[model samples]
Each structure stands twice: as C-alpha cells, then as structure tokens.
Target: MTYDPTNTPAWKRLLTIETMFKEGNERDRLAREAAATAASFPRVIARYLTDAGKALGDKALAVTVTETGPRDDEGRSAFTVGNCTVCPAATTEFWETAIYGGYESDVRLTVTEAAQGAEQVVRRWAEAHATRCRELPVEG
Candidate 1:
C-alpha cells in the first residue's frame, strides 16, 4: 500500500510535525520519542470519536507514522504510525539496519505494521473523531 502523512488525522499531523523537529541521532532514542508522540495522536482521535459517537465510521479517519532502522534482531526496537480511515495503510516489513561500526542504526517498519498498529490507532481515532464529529455544525 501507500503511506501518506499529509492525509493523517489533524492531531496526528501535529505529532508528526513535532517529531520531525526533534533532534536526535540515536536510533532507540528517536524511536522512543516517535512512539511517544504517536501514542498521543491516537488518544486525541479517540477523544473526538467518543464525543461524536454515531458519526464515526461514516467519516472514519485513520493515521500512520513509521520510523525505519536500528537493527540486528535479538530484541531490536521499531517505531511507526498507521491509519486507514484517511489513507491506505502501508504494507512493507520493518527492517533494522546497523551501520558505522554500530555508531549509527535505523528502524525500518513494514506496511503490514499498519495492520498491527491500526487496532490501537483506530480506537484512539474513534474517541476523538466522535467528539469532533459532534461539534461539526449541521451542514443543512
């Protein structure tokens, strides 16, 4: 599938923008930061969904975030964001890459992670989407 950050939920978009501005060279640190940021996006979406209730699935929104590298198996860490409601979820496997005598590493996540990640992401999206959906003024 294809990964499009632009179409991500608004709150998620803010999270990604923050992550991009963050400064870090360590793969784990960056992944942790990214995961934390991603964790928040879903919460925001869920909050809105809870408020909106019924209007959800009709305009269901999903978001995805992916961080690639920092590898060699044996308990390596990966980071990513996934949302299908707004755009198609990705479908590539995450890969861990090691480089420069272990001085540098990258976390690569597959599109499939979107599937695994969606469950959590969607719940969060629903909550927030619900809230926002309720607030939308009647278009009639």
Candidate 2:
C-alpha cells in the first residue's frame, strides 16, 4: 500500500506546517541580522581602532591593529593588535576589562570590579604591551 498522510489528523498536519514556517522565518531573520552585522563590521571595527589610537596617545603607531569582532551577548567587542587581544570585561557594570597574550608570556588581566573608564585604561595597557611584544602565534 502507498503511504498515507491522511492517517495523521488534519489539525496536526496543519500545526506541523505552521511550525515549519515559523522556524524558517526565524532562521531567515537571524541570517539577515548576521549578514548586516558582518557587512557593517569593518566600519565598526575601524571606529573602535580609531578610538584605541586616541587612547594610545603618543604610542598610537607602535601597535599594529589586527582582527576585531563583537561579542553581542556579552555587550562587548574585541580586537587583536600585535600579539595581544583586548576586550571589555564581562561584568554587570561592563566597566572592567581584560587583556590576553604577551611576549612569550601567557599574560592576562581580568578585573572583577572596576570604576568607570577601566576599559580605556585596559586598552591603553594592551596597546603598549602589543608594541613591545615580539612573540609570534604558534601554528597548529
């Protein structure tokens, strides 16, 4: 005998189709948002890098800006310059910051709590360390 979907209730079939449509729409919306975010990333990162430079002051040119991206859920973004990576600390206030990587050192700075402008201070420190760091990343 041929397969028969009629064995299933009409309302159940309708519900299944409706669920599929809702899932598809949600996926499409997420894809669109991701695409828009990716497209705008370069400009956004450039602005952050520019801000990092201003924070760097006379040492601005010493560090080479590299990769950058957002951590939206954490309410922060990060960028790597030279051998170091810097990002805002994940806290309730989002006032703290963290920096990782250094010259042949597994250096990390994590602040559980901080006053305002802590991120700026971390950025400045990260930039300075990046300038002097000569350690290259190891390839897998």
Candidate 1 — what's its lDDT? 0.40
Superposed model 2: Cα runs more than 4 Å off:
1-8, 44-67, 74-78, 82-140
State candidate 1's TM-score. 0.22
Question: Candidate 2, clashing residue pairs?
Answer: 89-97
lDDT of each: 0.40, 0.42
Looking at candidate 2, the ten consecutive residues that score lowest on lDDT are: 87-96
Leading candidate by lDDT: 2
Q: How many residue pairs clash in each candidate?
A: 44, 1
Put down candidate 1 lDDT per residue, 1-140, tens digits, no spaces: 79887667986989877787664446679688767665653222222222322444543333333334322223534433333343343332222222111212244434333324433444455444433433432345
